[model samples]
Target chain A: MEILSSFIKNPRKTTYGGEDNDEKIIFLLRKSVIVNINWVTVAFILLLLPLFVSPPLSKLTYMGMRVINPGFILALNLFWYIFTIGFIFQNFLAWYFDVLMVTNKKVIDIDQSCTDVSETTLSNVQDVSSKVKGTWGVVLDIGDIFIQTSAEQREFEFLDVSNPSKVRDEIADLVAKIKKRNGS
Target chain B: MVPNLPIRQLVIAGKIIVILIMVLYAVFAFILTKRVKLMNANLTTPQSKLFERIARIHMVLSIFVIILATINL
Candidate 1:
Protein backbone atom coordinates (compact mmCIF):
# COMPACT_ATOMS: atom_id res chain seq x y z
CA MET A 1 0.00 0.00 0.00
CA GLU A 2 2.89 2.38 0.71
CA ILE A 3 4.39 1.55 -2.66
CA LEU A 4 1.01 2.08 -4.30
CA SER A 5 0.69 5.48 -2.69
CA SER A 6 4.07 6.56 -4.07
CA PHE A 7 2.55 6.73 -7.53
CA ILE A 8 -0.75 8.19 -6.40
CA LYS A 9 -2.02 11.68 -7.09
CA ASN A 10 -2.55 12.71 -3.50
CA PRO A 11 -0.01 11.37 -1.07
CA ARG A 12 -1.12 11.77 2.55
CA LYS A 13 1.86 13.77 3.77
CA THR A 14 4.70 15.43 1.85
CA THR A 15 6.94 18.48 2.21
CA TYR A 16 9.08 20.71 0.01
CA GLY A 17 11.97 23.08 0.51
CA GLY A 18 11.09 26.61 1.72
CA GLU A 19 7.71 25.56 3.07
CA ASP A 20 6.43 27.82 5.83
CA ASN A 21 6.13 26.38 9.34
CA ASP A 22 2.39 26.92 9.45
CA GLU A 23 1.74 25.90 5.82
CA LYS A 24 0.11 22.49 5.49
CA ILE A 25 0.49 20.22 2.51
CA ILE A 26 -2.97 19.67 1.02
CA PHE A 27 -2.08 17.60 -2.05
CA LEU A 28 0.99 15.98 -3.57
CA LEU A 29 -0.09 15.16 -7.10
CA ARG A 30 1.69 12.88 -9.53
CA LYS A 31 0.69 11.99 -13.05
CA SER A 32 -1.27 8.74 -12.93
CA VAL A 33 0.79 5.54 -13.07
CA ILE A 34 -1.47 4.43 -15.90
CA VAL A 35 0.35 6.93 -18.12
CA ASN A 36 3.54 4.88 -17.68
CA ILE A 37 2.17 2.17 -19.98
CA ASN A 38 4.10 3.59 -22.93
CA TRP A 39 7.62 2.99 -21.61
CA VAL A 40 6.61 -0.03 -19.54
CA THR A 41 5.35 -1.70 -22.71
CA VAL A 42 8.58 -0.86 -24.51
CA ALA A 43 10.67 -2.24 -21.66
CA PHE A 44 8.54 -5.40 -21.62
CA ILE A 45 9.02 -5.93 -25.34
CA LEU A 46 12.79 -5.34 -25.08
CA LEU A 47 13.10 -7.77 -22.19
CA LEU A 48 11.38 -10.48 -24.25
CA LEU A 49 13.34 -9.83 -27.46
CA PRO A 50 16.55 -11.42 -26.16
CA LEU A 51 14.75 -14.58 -25.10
CA PHE A 52 13.23 -15.00 -28.53
CA VAL A 53 16.58 -14.38 -30.22
CA SER A 54 18.65 -16.59 -27.89
CA PRO A 55 18.40 -19.56 -30.24
CA PRO A 56 19.67 -17.65 -33.24
CA LEU A 57 22.14 -15.73 -31.10
CA SER A 58 23.66 -18.93 -29.80
CA LYS A 59 24.56 -20.08 -33.30
CA LEU A 60 27.01 -17.24 -33.97
CA THR A 61 30.75 -17.99 -33.48
CA TYR A 62 33.38 -15.55 -32.21
CA MET A 63 36.70 -17.40 -32.41
CA GLY A 64 37.08 -21.09 -33.40
CA MET A 65 34.20 -22.40 -31.30
CA ARG A 66 30.95 -23.46 -32.97
CA VAL A 67 29.17 -21.09 -30.60
CA ILE A 68 30.68 -17.70 -29.67
CA ASN A 69 31.52 -18.85 -26.14
CA PRO A 70 29.08 -19.56 -23.36
CA GLY A 71 30.91 -17.20 -21.00
CA PHE A 72 31.05 -14.36 -23.52
CA ILE A 73 27.40 -14.83 -24.42
CA LEU A 74 26.42 -14.79 -20.76
CA ALA A 75 28.42 -11.59 -20.24
CA LEU A 76 26.69 -10.05 -23.26
CA ASN A 77 23.33 -11.03 -21.88
CA LEU A 78 24.27 -9.49 -18.53
CA PHE A 79 25.06 -6.19 -20.25
CA TRP A 80 21.75 -6.29 -22.10
CA TYR A 81 19.79 -6.86 -18.92
CA ILE A 82 21.62 -4.07 -17.09
CA PHE A 83 20.93 -1.68 -19.96
CA THR A 84 17.23 -2.52 -19.84
CA ILE A 85 17.11 -2.11 -16.08
CA GLY A 86 18.69 1.32 -16.37
CA PHE A 87 16.11 2.32 -18.95
CA ILE A 88 13.28 1.24 -16.69
CA PHE A 89 14.82 3.00 -13.70
CA GLN A 90 15.24 6.25 -15.61
CA ASN A 91 11.61 6.19 -16.72
CA PHE A 92 10.35 5.36 -13.26
CA LEU A 93 12.39 8.14 -11.64
CA ALA A 94 11.05 10.64 -14.14
CA TRP A 95 7.48 9.65 -13.34
CA TYR A 96 7.94 9.24 -9.62
CA PHE A 97 9.66 12.55 -9.02
CA ASP A 98 7.61 14.75 -11.32
CA VAL A 99 4.91 16.22 -9.11
CA LEU A 100 2.63 19.15 -8.37
CA MET A 101 2.06 20.02 -4.72
CA VAL A 102 -0.56 22.23 -3.15
CA THR A 103 0.01 23.86 0.22
CA ASN A 104 -2.17 26.17 2.24
CA LYS A 105 -0.05 29.11 1.08
CA LYS A 106 1.14 28.13 -2.41
CA VAL A 107 1.26 25.66 -5.30
CA ILE A 108 4.49 24.06 -6.44
CA ASP A 109 5.00 22.21 -9.71
CA ILE A 110 8.17 20.23 -10.13
CA ASP A 111 9.49 18.50 -13.21
CA GLN A 112 12.16 16.37 -11.62
CA SER A 113 13.67 15.00 -14.81
CA CYS A 114 14.34 18.54 -15.97
CA THR A 115 14.82 19.94 -12.48
CA ASP A 116 12.26 22.61 -13.27
CA VAL A 117 9.99 24.22 -10.69
CA SER A 118 7.06 26.57 -11.04
CA GLU A 119 5.26 28.00 -8.06
CA THR A 120 2.46 30.45 -7.31
CA THR A 121 1.13 31.79 -4.06
CA LEU A 122 -2.47 30.94 -3.13
CA SER A 123 -3.43 34.61 -3.14
CA ASN A 124 -2.41 34.93 -6.79
CA VAL A 125 -4.14 31.75 -7.98
CA GLN A 126 -6.97 33.28 -9.99
CA ASP A 127 -8.98 30.24 -11.09
CA VAL A 128 -8.90 26.45 -11.23
CA SER A 129 -10.66 24.03 -13.59
CA SER A 130 -10.69 20.29 -14.36
CA LYS A 131 -10.98 18.56 -17.74
CA VAL A 132 -11.60 14.82 -18.14
CA LYS A 133 -11.21 13.18 -21.50
CA GLY A 134 -12.48 10.02 -23.24
CA THR A 135 -13.95 6.75 -21.92
CA TRP A 136 -10.94 5.52 -19.95
CA GLY A 137 -10.70 8.83 -18.10
CA VAL A 138 -14.39 8.63 -17.22
CA VAL A 139 -14.04 5.08 -15.97
CA LEU A 140 -10.80 5.59 -14.08
CA ASP A 141 -11.60 9.08 -12.85
CA ILE A 142 -8.36 10.32 -14.40
CA GLY A 143 -7.97 13.74 -16.00
CA ASP A 144 -6.13 17.06 -16.10
CA ILE A 145 -6.65 20.08 -13.86
CA PHE A 146 -5.78 23.49 -15.22
CA ILE A 147 -4.90 26.19 -12.72
CA GLN A 148 -4.94 29.72 -14.02
CA THR A 149 -2.80 31.93 -11.85
CA SER A 150 -2.28 35.67 -11.80
CA ALA A 151 1.39 35.27 -10.85
CA GLU A 152 4.25 35.22 -13.35
CA GLN A 153 3.43 31.53 -13.84
CA ARG A 154 0.12 31.61 -15.68
CA GLU A 155 -0.74 27.95 -16.34
CA PHE A 156 -0.45 24.83 -14.24
CA GLU A 157 -1.65 21.74 -16.08
CA PHE A 158 -1.78 18.63 -13.91
CA LEU A 159 -2.11 15.87 -16.45
CA ASP A 160 -3.51 12.36 -16.01
CA VAL A 161 -4.21 12.85 -12.33
CA SER A 162 -6.76 10.85 -10.36
CA ASN A 163 -9.82 12.75 -9.06
CA PRO A 164 -9.17 15.91 -11.05
CA SER A 165 -12.38 17.56 -9.89
CA LYS A 166 -11.58 16.97 -6.26
CA VAL A 167 -8.03 18.31 -6.64
CA ARG A 168 -9.37 21.42 -8.35
CA ASP A 169 -11.95 21.94 -5.66
CA GLU A 170 -9.37 21.59 -2.91
CA ILE A 171 -7.05 24.15 -4.49
CA ALA A 172 -10.04 26.36 -5.21
CA ASP A 173 -11.02 26.06 -1.59
CA LEU A 174 -7.55 27.10 -0.48
CA VAL A 175 -7.76 30.15 -2.67
CA ALA A 176 -11.18 30.93 -1.26
CA LYS A 177 -9.87 30.58 2.27
CA ILE A 178 -7.02 32.94 1.49
CA LYS A 179 -9.45 35.45 0.08
CA LYS A 180 -11.60 35.20 3.18
CA ARG A 181 -8.58 35.61 5.48
CA ASN A 182 -7.51 38.77 3.68
CA GLY A 183 -11.02 40.18 3.84
CA SER A 184 -11.17 39.60 7.59
CA MET B 1 32.62 -12.17 -43.97
CA VAL B 2 36.06 -13.02 -42.60
CA PRO B 3 38.21 -10.45 -40.78
CA ASN B 4 41.40 -9.14 -42.35
CA LEU B 5 43.19 -9.74 -39.06
CA PRO B 6 42.76 -12.60 -36.55
CA ILE B 7 39.53 -13.73 -34.82
CA ARG B 8 41.21 -13.64 -31.38
CA GLN B 9 42.14 -9.99 -31.88
CA LEU B 10 38.61 -9.20 -32.99
CA VAL B 11 37.23 -10.89 -29.83
CA ILE B 12 39.67 -8.93 -27.66
CA ALA B 13 38.64 -5.67 -29.35
CA GLY B 14 34.98 -6.44 -28.86
CA LYS B 15 35.52 -7.14 -25.17
CA ILE B 16 37.41 -3.87 -24.77
CA ILE B 17 34.56 -1.97 -26.46
CA VAL B 18 31.99 -3.56 -24.18
CA ILE B 19 34.04 -2.74 -21.09
CA LEU B 20 34.27 0.87 -22.21
CA ILE B 21 30.52 1.01 -22.67
CA MET B 22 29.95 -0.43 -19.20
CA VAL B 23 32.30 2.14 -17.71
CA LEU B 24 30.36 4.95 -19.41
CA TYR B 25 27.14 3.46 -18.08
CA ALA B 26 28.62 3.45 -14.60
CA VAL B 27 29.44 7.13 -14.91
CA PHE B 28 25.91 7.87 -16.07
CA ALA B 29 24.49 6.01 -13.09
CA PHE B 30 26.64 8.07 -10.72
CA ILE B 31 25.32 11.26 -12.28
CA LEU B 32 21.80 9.94 -11.92
CA THR B 33 22.43 9.28 -8.25
CA LYS B 34 23.54 12.88 -7.79
CA ARG B 35 20.47 14.16 -9.60
CA VAL B 36 18.19 12.02 -7.46
CA LYS B 37 19.82 13.36 -4.33
CA LEU B 38 19.38 16.92 -5.51
CA MET B 39 15.73 16.34 -6.29
CA ASN B 40 15.18 14.72 -2.93
CA ALA B 41 16.64 17.80 -1.30
CA ASN B 42 14.32 19.97 -3.36
CA LEU B 43 11.24 18.04 -2.31
CA THR B 44 11.31 15.84 0.74
CA THR B 45 8.71 13.13 0.21
CA PRO B 46 7.75 10.09 2.26
CA GLN B 47 9.45 7.91 -0.38
CA SER B 48 12.53 10.10 -0.70
CA LYS B 49 14.76 7.81 1.29
CA LEU B 50 13.63 4.81 -0.72
CA PHE B 51 14.33 6.55 -4.00
CA GLU B 52 17.77 7.69 -2.79
CA ARG B 53 18.66 4.14 -1.80
CA ILE B 54 17.53 2.77 -5.14
CA ALA B 55 19.63 5.36 -6.94
CA ARG B 56 22.69 4.47 -4.87
CA ILE B 57 22.12 0.76 -5.50
CA HIS B 58 21.81 1.41 -9.21
CA MET B 59 25.11 3.28 -9.19
CA VAL B 60 26.83 0.43 -7.37
CA LEU B 61 25.38 -2.17 -9.71
CA SER B 62 26.50 -0.18 -12.72
CA ILE B 63 30.07 -0.19 -11.42
CA PHE B 64 29.80 -3.89 -10.64
CA VAL B 65 28.70 -4.57 -14.20
CA ILE B 66 31.83 -2.89 -15.49
CA ILE B 67 34.03 -5.00 -13.23
CA LEU B 68 32.28 -8.23 -14.22
CA ALA B 69 32.59 -7.39 -17.89
CA THR B 70 36.31 -6.72 -17.45
CA ILE B 71 36.73 -10.17 -15.92
CA ASN B 72 34.33 -12.24 -18.07
CA LEU B 73 34.27 -10.44 -21.39
Candidate 2:
Protein backbone atom coordinates (compact mmCIF):
# COMPACT_ATOMS: atom_id res chain seq x y z
CA MET A 1 0.00 0.00 0.00
CA GLU A 2 2.86 2.36 0.76
CA ILE A 3 4.36 1.64 -2.63
CA LEU A 4 1.04 2.30 -4.31
CA SER A 5 0.41 5.66 -2.64
CA SER A 6 3.99 6.82 -2.23
CA PHE A 7 4.36 10.52 -2.92
CA ILE A 8 3.79 11.54 -6.51
CA LYS A 9 5.32 14.66 -7.98
CA ASN A 10 2.39 15.30 -10.26
CA PRO A 11 -0.55 13.03 -9.55
CA ARG A 12 -3.59 12.81 -11.76
CA LYS A 13 -7.31 12.82 -10.99
CA THR A 14 -7.01 13.78 -7.34
CA THR A 15 -10.07 15.34 -5.70
CA TYR A 16 -8.45 15.99 -2.35
CA GLY A 17 -9.11 19.73 -2.31
CA GLY A 18 -12.67 19.30 -3.52
CA GLU A 19 -14.55 18.59 -6.76
CA ASP A 20 -14.13 22.11 -7.99
CA ASN A 21 -13.87 22.39 -11.73
CA ASP A 22 -10.72 23.54 -13.58
CA GLU A 23 -8.30 22.70 -10.78
CA LYS A 24 -5.47 20.30 -11.60
CA ILE A 25 -3.04 19.01 -9.01
CA ILE A 26 0.57 19.92 -9.73
CA PHE A 27 2.32 18.39 -6.74
CA LEU A 28 1.41 16.14 -3.82
CA LEU A 29 3.73 15.90 -0.83
CA ARG A 30 3.82 14.33 2.60
CA LYS A 31 5.74 15.54 5.63
CA SER A 32 9.52 15.44 5.82
CA VAL A 33 11.45 12.18 5.80
CA ILE A 34 12.43 12.84 9.41
CA VAL A 35 8.85 12.59 10.64
CA ASN A 36 8.39 9.17 9.07
CA ILE A 37 11.74 8.03 10.42
CA ASN A 38 10.59 8.96 13.90
CA TRP A 39 7.47 6.87 13.50
CA VAL A 40 9.55 3.92 12.31
CA THR A 41 11.89 4.25 15.25
CA VAL A 42 9.07 4.25 17.76
CA ALA A 43 7.42 1.26 16.12
CA PHE A 44 10.67 -0.67 16.08
CA ILE A 45 11.13 -0.01 19.77
CA LEU A 46 7.61 -1.15 20.55
CA LEU A 47 8.09 -4.31 18.50
CA LEU A 48 11.26 -5.22 20.37
CA LEU A 49 10.03 -4.44 23.88
CA PRO A 50 8.04 -7.67 24.25
CA LEU A 51 11.07 -9.77 23.30
CA PHE A 52 13.11 -8.08 26.01
CA VAL A 53 10.44 -8.19 28.73
CA SER A 54 8.68 -11.50 28.10
CA PRO A 55 11.58 -13.67 29.22
CA PRO A 56 12.06 -11.99 32.63
CA LEU A 57 8.30 -11.83 33.15
CA SER A 58 7.86 -15.51 32.39
CA LYS A 59 10.83 -16.45 34.54
CA LEU A 60 9.43 -14.48 37.46
CA THR A 61 6.06 -16.20 37.01
CA TYR A 62 7.77 -19.60 36.92
CA MET A 63 9.65 -18.84 40.18
CA GLY A 64 6.27 -18.19 41.89
CA MET A 65 7.33 -14.66 42.68
CA ARG A 66 4.43 -13.31 40.63
CA VAL A 67 0.82 -14.04 41.49
CA ILE A 68 -0.51 -13.75 37.92
CA ASN A 69 -1.93 -16.91 36.38
CA PRO A 70 0.01 -18.20 33.37
CA GLY A 71 -3.09 -18.11 31.20
CA PHE A 72 -3.85 -14.56 32.21
CA ILE A 73 -0.27 -13.57 31.49
CA LEU A 74 -0.47 -15.14 28.04
CA ALA A 75 -3.68 -13.29 27.27
CA LEU A 76 -2.15 -10.04 28.44
CA ASN A 77 0.85 -10.53 26.17
CA LEU A 78 -1.43 -11.14 23.23
CA PHE A 79 -3.37 -8.00 24.08
CA TRP A 80 -0.15 -6.01 24.21
CA TYR A 81 0.88 -7.22 20.79
CA ILE A 82 -2.49 -6.25 19.33
CA PHE A 83 -2.34 -2.86 20.95
CA THR A 84 1.16 -2.25 19.65
CA ILE A 85 0.27 -3.11 16.08
CA GLY A 86 -2.85 -0.96 16.26
CA PHE A 87 -0.91 1.96 17.65
CA ILE A 88 1.65 1.74 14.87
CA PHE A 89 -1.04 1.67 12.23
CA GLN A 90 -2.81 4.65 13.77
CA ASN A 91 0.38 6.67 13.52
CA PHE A 92 0.80 5.70 9.91
CA LEU A 93 -2.72 6.80 9.14
CA ALA A 94 -2.07 10.20 10.65
CA TRP A 95 1.16 10.65 8.73
CA TYR A 96 -0.23 9.44 5.44
CA PHE A 97 -3.28 11.68 5.46
CA ASP A 98 -1.52 14.86 6.50
CA VAL A 99 -0.62 16.43 3.15
CA LEU A 100 0.55 19.55 1.36
CA MET A 101 -0.93 19.92 -2.09
CA VAL A 102 -0.20 22.42 -4.84
CA THR A 103 -2.66 22.94 -7.63
CA ASN A 104 -2.86 25.41 -10.47
CA LYS A 105 -5.26 27.67 -8.63
CA LYS A 106 -4.47 27.14 -4.96
CA VAL A 107 -2.07 25.65 -2.47
CA ILE A 108 -3.74 23.52 0.19
CA ASP A 109 -2.17 22.51 3.45
CA ILE A 110 -3.85 19.77 5.42
CA ASP A 111 -2.90 18.68 8.90
CA GLN A 112 -4.92 15.76 10.19
CA SER A 113 -4.63 13.91 13.48
CA CYS A 114 -6.83 11.33 15.18
CA THR A 115 -9.37 13.78 16.57
CA ASP A 116 -8.82 16.99 14.61
CA VAL A 117 -8.38 18.41 11.14
CA SER A 118 -6.88 21.79 10.24
CA GLU A 119 -6.75 22.87 6.61
CA THR A 120 -5.74 26.07 4.89
CA THR A 121 -5.90 27.18 1.26
CA LEU A 122 -4.18 30.04 -0.46
CA SER A 123 -5.32 31.16 -3.92
CA ASN A 124 -3.74 34.56 -4.23
CA VAL A 125 -0.13 33.66 -3.70
CA GLN A 126 2.23 36.65 -4.14
CA ASP A 127 5.58 35.06 -3.30
CA VAL A 128 7.03 31.67 -2.40
CA SER A 129 10.15 30.54 -0.55
CA SER A 130 11.57 27.26 0.80
CA LYS A 131 14.26 26.74 3.38
CA VAL A 132 16.35 23.67 4.18
CA LYS A 133 18.12 24.40 7.43
CA GLY A 134 19.72 22.18 10.10
CA THR A 135 22.06 19.27 9.48
CA TRP A 136 19.30 16.68 9.14
CA GLY A 137 17.18 18.75 6.76
CA VAL A 138 20.04 19.67 4.45
CA VAL A 139 21.42 16.14 4.43
CA LEU A 140 18.01 14.58 3.83
CA ASP A 141 16.62 17.18 1.35
CA ILE A 142 13.80 18.13 3.68
CA GLY A 143 12.47 21.45 4.98
CA ASP A 144 9.54 23.85 4.90
CA ILE A 145 7.80 25.72 2.04
CA PHE A 146 6.31 29.12 2.73
CA ILE A 147 3.66 30.73 0.55
CA GLN A 148 2.82 34.39 1.03
CA THR A 149 -0.48 35.33 -0.48
CA SER A 150 -3.05 38.14 -0.44
CA ALA A 151 -5.31 36.25 1.93
CA GLU A 152 -6.09 37.81 5.31
CA GLN A 153 -4.91 34.68 7.11
CA ARG A 154 -1.32 33.81 7.86
CA GLU A 155 1.09 32.68 5.16
CA PHE A 156 0.48 29.06 4.13
CA GLU A 157 3.36 26.94 5.31
CA PHE A 158 4.13 23.42 4.13
CA LEU A 159 5.97 22.40 7.27
CA ASP A 160 8.64 19.73 7.33
CA VAL A 161 8.33 18.45 3.79
CA SER A 162 10.98 16.92 1.55
CA ASN A 163 12.54 18.63 -1.49
CA PRO A 164 11.57 22.14 -0.47
CA SER A 165 13.56 23.74 -3.30
CA LYS A 166 11.79 21.77 -5.96
CA VAL A 167 8.43 22.46 -4.30
CA ARG A 168 9.17 26.16 -4.22
CA ASP A 169 10.16 26.22 -7.87
CA GLU A 170 7.00 24.37 -8.86
CA ILE A 171 4.80 26.75 -6.92
CA ALA A 172 6.72 29.72 -8.35
CA ASP A 173 6.17 28.42 -11.84
CA LEU A 174 2.46 27.97 -11.12
CA VAL A 175 2.23 31.46 -9.68
CA ALA A 176 3.88 32.82 -12.80
CA LYS A 177 1.35 31.08 -14.95
CA ILE A 178 -1.50 32.30 -12.80
CA LYS A 179 -0.19 35.85 -13.12
CA LYS A 180 0.22 35.52 -16.86
CA ARG A 181 -3.30 34.17 -17.21
CA ASN A 182 -4.75 36.92 -15.05
CA GLY A 183 -2.70 39.47 -17.04
CA SER A 184 -1.77 41.16 -13.73
CA MET B 1 -15.87 -29.48 44.84
CA VAL B 2 -17.86 -26.25 44.75
CA PRO B 3 -16.10 -22.91 44.43
CA ASN B 4 -16.63 -20.30 47.17
CA LEU B 5 -19.84 -18.30 46.51
CA PRO B 6 -18.34 -14.82 47.03
CA ILE B 7 -15.35 -15.58 44.77
CA ARG B 8 -17.63 -16.78 42.00
CA GLN B 9 -19.78 -13.72 42.40
CA LEU B 10 -16.76 -11.46 42.26
CA VAL B 11 -15.50 -13.15 39.10
CA ILE B 12 -18.89 -12.73 37.45
CA ALA B 13 -18.97 -9.08 38.37
CA GLY B 14 -15.46 -8.55 37.05
CA LYS B 15 -16.40 -10.16 33.75
CA ILE B 16 -19.48 -7.98 33.49
CA ILE B 17 -17.46 -4.86 34.09
CA VAL B 18 -14.94 -5.90 31.42
CA ILE B 19 -17.74 -6.56 28.96
CA LEU B 20 -19.20 -3.15 29.65
CA ILE B 21 -15.84 -1.51 29.05
CA MET B 22 -15.45 -3.39 25.79
CA VAL B 23 -18.90 -2.27 24.63
CA LEU B 24 -18.05 1.33 25.37
CA TYR B 25 -14.78 1.00 23.46
CA ALA B 26 -16.60 -0.51 20.53
CA VAL B 27 -18.83 2.55 20.48
CA PHE B 28 -15.80 4.78 20.53
CA ALA B 29 -14.30 2.88 17.63
CA PHE B 30 -17.56 3.17 15.75
CA ILE B 31 -17.57 6.92 16.18
CA LEU B 32 -14.00 7.13 14.92
CA THR B 33 -14.91 5.11 11.84
CA LYS B 34 -17.79 7.45 11.14
CA ARG B 35 -15.49 10.46 11.35
CA VAL B 36 -13.06 8.85 8.94
CA LYS B 37 -15.88 8.20 6.53
CA LEU B 38 -16.86 11.83 6.66
CA MET B 39 -13.30 12.94 6.08
CA ASN B 40 -12.96 10.59 3.14
CA ALA B 41 -16.07 11.97 1.52
CA ASN B 42 -14.39 15.36 1.05
CA LEU B 43 -11.04 14.06 -0.22
CA THR B 44 -10.37 11.47 -2.89
CA THR B 45 -6.72 10.70 -2.31
CA PRO B 46 -5.00 7.33 -2.05
CA GLN B 47 -3.95 8.11 1.51
CA SER B 48 -7.51 8.92 2.49
CA LYS B 49 -8.75 5.58 1.21
CA LEU B 50 -5.99 3.75 3.02
CA PHE B 51 -6.77 5.64 6.23
CA GLU B 52 -10.47 4.79 5.96
CA ARG B 53 -9.63 1.13 5.46
CA ILE B 54 -7.35 1.08 8.50
CA ALA B 55 -9.99 2.75 10.65
CA ARG B 56 -12.68 0.27 9.57
CA ILE B 57 -10.42 -2.72 10.15
CA HIS B 58 -9.43 -1.39 13.53
CA MET B 59 -13.07 -0.99 14.51
CA VAL B 60 -14.00 -4.53 13.42
CA LEU B 61 -10.97 -6.15 15.00
CA SER B 62 -11.57 -4.29 18.26
CA ILE B 63 -15.05 -5.77 18.45
CA PHE B 64 -13.71 -9.24 17.75
CA VAL B 65 -11.04 -8.86 20.39
CA ILE B 66 -13.68 -7.81 22.86
CA ILE B 67 -15.78 -10.86 22.05
CA LEU B 68 -12.77 -13.14 22.43
CA ALA B 69 -11.94 -11.62 25.79
CA THR B 70 -15.49 -12.06 26.94
CA ILE B 71 -15.65 -15.72 25.93
CA ASN B 72 -12.13 -17.05 26.51
CA LEU B 73 -10.61 -14.87 29.24
Best lDDT among the predictions, by candidate number: 1
lDDT of 1 by residue, A65-162 (tens): 74356666666777777778889988987887788888777888989563788888877777899999999999998999899988877898889987
lDDT per residue, candidate 2, B27-61, as tens digits?
Answer: 76777778777666655665567777777887787
What lDDT, from 0 to 1, does candidate 2 have?
Answer: 0.67
Q: Model 2, residue A21: what's the lDDT?
A: 85
List candidate 1 segments past 4 Å from native. Answer: A6-13, A62-67, A134-140, A182-184, B1-5
Residues A1-184, candidate 2: write the lDDT tens digits.
4333435666754676363587777777777645777778888888888788777765652223443335544544555565566667666656766776776766777666423333334347778999988998888888888888777755877677778887788778877877788776
TM-score of each: 0.86, 0.77
Candidate 2 deviant stretches above 4 angstroms? A1-7, A55-71, A114-123, B1-28, B47-49
User: How would you encode candidate 1's per-residue C-alpha lDDT over B1-73 as one tens digit per residue?
Assistant: 8655676767788888878888888888899888888888878778788888888887887787777766765
How high is the lDDT of residue A1 in model 1?
60
Superposition error at A92 for model 1 (Å): 1.2
i-RMS for every candidate (Å) is 2.4, 4.4
Q: Give residue A131's lDDT in candidate 2 (0 to 100).
A: 91
Error of 1 at A18 (Å): 1.6
